[model samples]
Target: MRLNRGLPAVASSLLLALPLALAGCTSFGEGSEEPAAASATPTEVEAAPIEWSDCDAQIQPLIEGQPGSERDLLFECGRTEVPISYDEPAGATLPLFLVRATPAGQTERIGSLVVNPGGPGGSGADAAIGLALTLPQDVLGRFDIVGFDPRGVGLSTPVDCIPAELKDRVIASEPRPTTAEQLDDVFALSREMADGCAEEYGDALGTFNTVDTARDMEQLRKSLGDEQLTYLGYSYGTTLGSTYAELFPDRVRAMVLDAAVDPDTDVVADAEASAAGFEAGFDAFAENCKGLIAGCPLGDDPRRFLEELLAQAGGAPVPSSEEGETRQATPGVVLTAVQAALYDTASWPQLAQGLRAARDGDAKALFSLADELTGRLEDNSYSNLLDANLAVNCADTDEVVEETEVRRLVAEWSQAYPLFGAGSAAGLFTCSVWDAERTPVPERDAAGSAPILVVGNQGDPVTPLPGAVDMAEDLESGVLLTWQGQGHTAYPKTDCITAAVNAYLIDLVAPQDGLTCPA
Candidate 1:
């Protein structure tokens, strides 16, 4: 949500199994050394054209048993090579995966409309395939909906650092470590995960930064035979879209950024803001929970109740068993469950149910919610979301806070934001000991880009509304479209927002700036 470097499980779980919120790739700062002339522009040499093929065998099952026309949708998959680092176009390359969906019955097409959901690690190719099944028919008829996995993400060659078992252990660890030894153990695990990535990836890890991914997007644009880019990005995807606008503003035809990440917030500030935001969201949920059902699970004071529960879990995790596997529901696990539910208001009821069950000494419901957030399947396999999230995030920044500073922040944040403060603070050290060199991209105004539509949700816990406000104002030609609603991004959630977005993408008609659509 905040696009912070640490807290992969919290961030990735925000849009679990939902490609609509996948993030795009982009650089956040300039390279340590001046870029070679070659890096300034892609090589003139033509990359091989994509050879699209029927992907029905692999993609169709994802939508199997679903109702309506989506069942018959067709998808084409392809891959293209881009230089791992733009500085040396003739050097080693990486494969970028693509999934394209063309209108089933339309002859005249408007152009390509690329979509990114937003995990600095989210799979764009997967998002594209999902979009093919659910996007409005008119939108489908006019433009080729494309989803691409940036380098070091799904479908593309991924950064597989920690093994499934190791990752499970890391995620299932306690969130609030009271003792110095507990804290030391947390930091040690972080170091091991980071070191494992470096060992597995080597120098290739350096190329996973957003800048390289932004350049790859440009390559994608060219390969699609599009003269101008028409793009839709959510969450961290906004980072990619904004970076592209900064680097090649003139090439953008139309772009929509929903649930934007503020370009200015540092790691510490981002975590603090995220903690505050989730606290706000939890409060909203608690308020709505009142009177909706008898004997509300969170009780009269949800905040206080949660604090007690977390404290209890911290000392001794509740025992939970699912499918013959037993695990203790630690504070981290409980926090993950709560965070995952906060993503969609519809899940609030489920959260209440889970919490009620946890209170009664049955931890299965909470464990399921935690598994959903962490991508831990029944068989104990993982989706690689957490691995890629850390790989890309750690590679993007070079800020490292000492353990003492982290502990201080945890104390500070706990005072300010009780619900998620300490838990959020615990994630501060994730990128501190990472092995990759940071290639930070400077935040830009994106001065020459065409009018870009920026959408923000009123109740998003991850990418807060203020970040969207900042992002819209920072882009030279950006316009804000506010949704007075609860949830992450606006489009496709409500008819009003969806219609406006469709109109904007199809006709290039910007919504009245600052237009507020009802939830």
Candidate 2:
């Protein structure tokens, strides 16, 4: 799945609305029993404990300075080394970066509660700061929030494939190639990206698979002195969490997986589902914006209007201006802007404004949204998000359809889902030529594990609700919690959902199966 740049509004709002609550008397019982040893040999010599230090210089100052964001100042940063290949514990190792925030005041701490904010590429250390600030006080008091950048992400041993200049060109390339020349260019760029990674990292690229990361998580658990894993994972993070549960079923105390990625979904099915999801989200946005806004940009038929707009951009790229830097908006940029907005309905108003501006021949708003989605900063420097996302995803799955099949799917899906199908299909070639040994997504039954909570949003565009449903059913003890709402994940969307998750994580009382909260 592509990265969803939008943060859950409920989380941000909660952080702004409430001051950090000091810890109080809250006793979490002893941790769960340890599971059977993993298949990989345990290190003969235990790894050194993490050396904690103030992270003021490392954390982003803007987030630290935000109101009610003291946790950023309180966070401690550190690094730990683990074997890049778990099968060879004495072989090459990679350093994993971590950020941890403890409770404000003394309380009976449960243990370190690990978190990953989706991405397979997102900086979990960065996410920990946000999670520390936004999570409810009661929940905050009971657990030490720890976020780690996985083996090939963020501050960890990063996978730098494409250079910034080349990446900019790639992201701005034409999304839906209609002609042979354009298609050739698309294929060339895809190979360029994959080959670049192979050249930079060599065989090490194959070690970034989720299964390896799952082993790294176990090492992290031991390093943190936690008896078992307690986790909160969203979107792609759910994949990591489920993989961990599958690999070490008895190692879990509690886990909350929101906006799940179905392990069973192949690349083609993933593209098709994502296309339908974005179309559904767009339809909902169009219906809600009809009478709510004056001169709705989409008019009566949003589907048709968007299709025409995409076609127009493809033929002659729309010009976009930001802070005097001018660039043309290609179909790729437009689609990225749309996908970013689909993550959270709170951005729907901005999406409307952007679409309206685009219709009026000004693509500034849309370009800004696209820049945000792709992590293009004000200084034009890009993060390694796109790089690591591709690396990890390519390493995880082996399903690769040929360009001809992808083109056929695009043509068929474009007719079925006019808003996003062709563009979604256009993205199918990203991992086609990746040079990593594939690790199939695990079954994630997690039999005999503690009750795991799976939260699903009804109208999630990226990881649709059905994936969550399938994920819940796949896990032996999985409890499904439904949030009848919009957006990518549900925990930070509603009080009802948040309360349910908080209860699960802090109290280990999973919400009833089939529980549904209204939008």
Candidate 3:
């Protein structure tokens, strides 16, 4: 079955949000918007019960015509009426769309395994179906796999303020703007985007932060009839899971936070860490490429080829030869594709092929990869993934780097992190120019909660290895599980990681905190 791949929890302004940014045959309700608002504090409001129904109308279309999809599993959909603003429990409420996928021929069912794919924008509803299709029967048989699009995401009450054309322009812009003129262009674009979101959402925009989403999880748990939450959270979903663990420590039965985001780091710190991680990932790719028989597509030095490609792409448009494709190759698109490929090692060979094609002046391969990363559809229309991405990301943090600081960081990081530095530093301005109050990532600890497993990948590009280490340290009852693997996440991918997680989630047997598995 085709999967909803992992994406970063945090995306840069120029980078765009690429959470599970795969080209799709299934048009899963991409573009739609609902007005949102809230603040103060979460109150004790009874969760509206869920009435489960067939999900075929929405989900079947997604997996039907796809090459490998076998439509054999069962999926049910439901809606939970959650207060849009928990601060006002009796006030306006929005429907939180949910999908529950039953394991193949279950033996004895345990509680639900709430899986979150982790974009502040990632669709949990999509994740539920993906996990159902991919998860092993051992873990699957014991639990009902549940996924829901949190508020401000697909098929739910969304925080969609961004115009499609504007998003296209942002993705096509240069990621690393150095010159004063280029920086000016970025600033102007940022202002226009920020003003538009503000005009659309107003103060209600602030309500789209992480804390509120955590509260939504509480309601989801109650509605699922699970006495405690059993969650499998990834990437930005880790941020949400960690936050939930803190808010309702006692309510967490078993939680596996894979590819975690350190709650303590502010925006700049997170970006810097990502920059360092991407740089390392590129180096690894380069090493692997060099060891190949042909010895790398971009020649012995891939970095130099990228530099040249960026320069040429900026001056004369590098055309995409993808059939019926009209988009030109820009620096933003090139880097976005490269960044996306680095998320998983399986895509490195594809990345090499794209670069080789680019070397031959055909940008078709690059465009294909970039389109998948940005959720740019076959017709050039986009998904609401990026919309909710910017909305929740900005709302989650108050740290906004000023132009001067950004320029300084850009100059310094450009040298510090050779490939991704300058662009990432420029991206620091995304939240700065954003028009919303912040609910900064809180200091998280699953204090009284059951031992929550915090899994980390040594070569994770987006969340990075350090974030997971920090996550384990911060949580009072957190246990660290390290995979010396090279990918975005380690979970059913390897037998070692899978067995440990299955044992922990099913039997409540916590692995030793410092257990490290070889890649």
Candidate 4:
């Protein structure tokens, strides 16, 4: 239930399956160069144009039907048409959805604090609604939060590369091929998927990448008339913040990049690191399960329980109690389900209860959990923004290994992490075949006046600790903040982290060079 108590049985490499789309591309310069400063002029921030008639006619009815806190949250609907290519400046137009939420007081407006939740597919509008509830009160009061569905994501001009059946088949694919033939099929499938994207989407896919999104951010800044940008990016969003800082270094007033990803690493590197991180997380989960009987399903030997579970899942899935549905509860599905629950500790108890039920031959609980894991839930327990994620990743990754290479890697990783390596390797199948143009890595130089904060989680099963440490060393003004805990992304969860990040954002106070917090 509590997967982060030790480490995930699977490698965290699947995180890279989404690819590291956060932050600026190499175009920003190398690590040694000083980043340029933002314009200093204080200009009145302009409100985005809202079509009140359009809102009443089209958007209001949709909002009225929604029930709960989202209903109470103020809604401003608007659209911005950006060029398909930033370089072209006046190319084909794409409409982007913009959602704005003003803070309680008008006097404390800190301009628009652009927040991205980082699924590359996560709807910014949805994130804004949830963020309004979870954000630290002090931070919320000071900034007017703006969440936008990035191009080719959410309300934006989204991608429809895979048909519904193909998408379903792809998500439910076996963790790894059992034979050489299967691997070949996967390779062909991956290539086909990527090719489909390119063929279906064409040049429009190129604009969805992070570099272009950063340009979109700049456009947003221009539209708002703000000389500087403030941002809070989570998970993959950290990459976006980093990208923004890289492109418009002078314009970044303050940024909180939670669950940081190293800009220097490609998807391949990210895949390897993520795999290892999840293994570490599974270990933590096992350790926690050992002592807590009521909260954990595994009786006495946690490792043994996991081993048996994996074996059972891999062999043949059992029927679920819920609606008598027959589903393949493969180790991959189980691990993916468990991993999703680990994101927030709030879901731990539910997982524990489900596992307890699973131990009783009621696979329904696990199946339900898996459903939530895959974004079948209405609350968006999973990151449903795969279209944009694919666009960014397909563009960023210059090369994807063939099926043979993937199989070899899987075998190697399996040797390294016996329980979850295959699943991690399998997740990469999607990225390897994503369609788009391959470009050289951009030059990213972080040297500057203000210190850029890099947060790391010690037992993170996604973005490992080494990444933060390495990025800190790479950046000229990088400061490392280590959260000696488990899971991905630390800020807003820990008081110490929140205090540090809040201080940095509010007063431009960077924490000490190497700051670590213990659980």
Error of 2 at 296 (Å): 2.7
Sort by lDDT, best first: what order?
3, 2, 1, 4
Worst 10 residues of 4 by lDDT: 1-10
Task: Supply the TM-score for candidate 1.
Answer: 0.89
**TM-score, each model?**
0.89, 0.89, 0.91, 0.82
Model 2 shows how many backbone clashes? 0
lDDT tens readout by residue for model 4, 1-519: 011111111111122122222222221112212112112222223334422112323333343433333333454555666555544454344566666655444466567777887665666655655565566777777766677767766556666565544544555556545467756655666666678766765544554567667767777877766678878777677666676676667777777666676666765567777777767776777677666746466766656775676567667754566653545566656666666656555555666666656555666666666654443433322333444566666665566666667787777877776655665665577666665554323545544525677788887776778877776776667778889877777877789998998888777899997988875
1 or 3, greater by TM-score: 3
For model 4, what is the C-alpha lDDT against the true structure? 0.60
Question: Which regions of candidate 4 fall more than 4 Å away from where they truly are?
Answer: 1-73, 176-178, 293-295, 323-328, 377-384, 439-441, 447-449
Candidate 3 stretches with Cα past 4 Å from truth are 1-41, 57-61, 64-71
In model 2, the Cα lDDT at residue 207 comes to 68
**Whole-model alpha-carbon lDDT for candidate 2:** 0.76
**Please, what are the lDDT tens digits per residue for candidate 3 over residues 1-519?**
011236432111211222222222111133323224444345677988986787555565566654324636777877777776775677766677778887557887888999898776777877777777677778888999898888777767666677778877887887777777887787788788788877776666776778888998999999889999999998888888998888888899999999888677777888888889888988888888888996678788887888888888888878877778777888888888898888888788899889778767788888767766666666576656777888788887777689999889888998899778887888777778888767776778768889999999998877788888999999999899999988788887898899899999999998999899989
| Displacement of the residue 485 alpha carbon in candidate 4, Å | 1.7
lDDT of 2 by residue, 1-519 (tens): 266332432122222221111122111111212122124322333555675677544444546466456542366777777765555676555677788877668388899889988877777776787787778887788888898878777667666777888777787787656566776787788888888887776666776778778888888898999999999998989999998898888889999999998767788898889889888988888887776747676788766777788888888888875656667887778877887888878788888888777867879988777776675666676767788888888877778888988778777887898767776786788788888666666667988899999988888888889898999999999999998888788876689998899888888998899899999
Model 2 TM-score, 2 decimals: 0.89
